[model samples]
Target: MLELILALRNALVQQGLELRAQEASDWQGEIPLPADIARFYRDIGPDNCNLATAGNSFFIPALARLWRMQAGYRWHGISGERLTDWHDDWLAVADQGGDPFIFETSSGKVLHDRHGGGSWQPAPLFDSLEQMIACLATFDAVWNSAGEDIFLDDYSVNPRHRERLIDALIPLLNSRSAAQSLADELGW
Candidate 1:
């Protein structure tokens, strides 16, 4: 997991994005973060790197900001009513636009939920945090290297680049189906 996190940091650096290390004390939440997740925040914390594709904006907040974000997702803004489906063990580690990528403390699996779905039900996205970081690193690589011909005027990925992305993701994800699912989720 540390290797994957470093690789992701290196990949982002190659793209000229800067990331700063976070202190362990930064994570003062009542619910303890999984070790790997905590390591990620400590090694490659938040940044405004614009990890945006035509499909989604991948944003991972700093630990300090996580609670507010989680609270909003867990409770209705207007009514301040708690969402029955939102679980205490599910911590939102990242987000695709408004949709959250949740870390399940009990299962050690990463799940994704579509925003405005009106429920907290999330689908399995990755077997572990390591896999999720690997996918992100692969996506960063492919997205940066995609030629102009691989993108339409609207910046959506062309089919060629989409195939390239899936190919790149396969080995990192260790499953063709998982790679394909990630591409589909990215709308590639």
Candidate 2:
């Protein structure tokens, strides 16, 4: 089993790919999270195509960033966004029980827990598609279009950080017991 893991890892790396693990806080719970929910969390990242959970370990691609790490997450890529206000607004919306469509952060305040932490604001009065389109069109014409340069500039400073990012590769690949256990549990 371990040999198979090693072989799989080697095959992947030979193809210029890496098997990186993106940690999830949900997997830290005593009971395993629902597979559907876990997969949803894993999909928060652009590159995370598969999600598997064994015991407390949830395996996912390491390239996931804060934006793609959680469900219904949003961010504003403005250059001078501040954290204090962001948190305040998030809490405000959360207090209102509204789910916000977009999350915005600027240069001054770095969003903490980009993967899946910090506070959230619930979006009010825009839950419906019509409301969402209306809200977005307004925002697009007012804020997004005018501030496009600042947003682009922020990403340009560190473009890699904005996209799926994997900093390192696992030096040792495959855990045979783990593979066997997974197969056994799945009846594979």
Candidate 3:
């Protein structure tokens, strides 16, 4: 896991992508997590994310809400199992290539719907949060870090989203040194 996360960090740095986090104190009064989920956070916390960087959204504790909110709002289709309803037994944790990482509410299952997010064949790519994180970290290292053309070839959802994502990330690519410094400072 350490090796995988490091590879992702290195890839992002090579591409000038910046990761940020807030202070631990910022997480103090935030919405409480489920006992199980909170336990997971306690075990991994900010360290669980590949996107984490010093002062970036992923590394900071206070910004967990923002991350969770983004995850929660992703109401795309989920696994291919029994519970297929939009929001019934799942919570979104992350999204890549239009597919979402989801947590089963009733059963503590973590799943990644990589089949276009719900083409009716919702097979789970992973069964644990750690596995999901690893998948994302690997994807970041292998795909998103390469360049626009590569990202487009693989993760492009549509022309609009593609253009917007490229536009948003290109600036980070343009300013690599600053972002690299932050990652180095954060020991990411």
lDDT of each: 0.74, 0.28, 0.42
When sorted by lDDT, best at the front, the candidate numbers are: 1, 3, 2
lDDT of 2 at 86: 44
* Candidate 2 residue runs with Cα over 4 Å from true position: 20-60, 63-188
In candidate 1, position 30 carries an lDDT of 63
Cα TM-score per model: 0.83, 0.20, 0.41
Record all residue pairs in model 3 with backbone atoms less than 3 Å apart, i.e. clashing: 20-55, 20-56, 20-57, 21-55, 21-56, 21-60, 22-60, 80-122
Model 2 agreement with the true structure over 70-115: per-residue lDDT tens digits: 3233333454334443442221111011223332221111111222
Say which candidate scores most in lDDT: 1
* Window of ten residues with lowest summed lDDT in model 1: 45-54
Candidates in order: C-alpha RMSD to true structure: 2.6, 20.1, 12.7
For candidate 1, the C-alpha RMSD (Å) to the true structure equals 2.6
Q: Output the lDDT of residue 59, model 3.
A: 23
Question: Positional deviation of 37 in candidate 2, in angstroms?
Answer: 13
Q: lDDT tens digits, residues 1-188, model 3?
A: 65654654555445444344334443432334445455444443433343421122222222355244333233322532334345555655554433455666566766545433434334454455544444334334434434444424555333443333334433443444533432232223
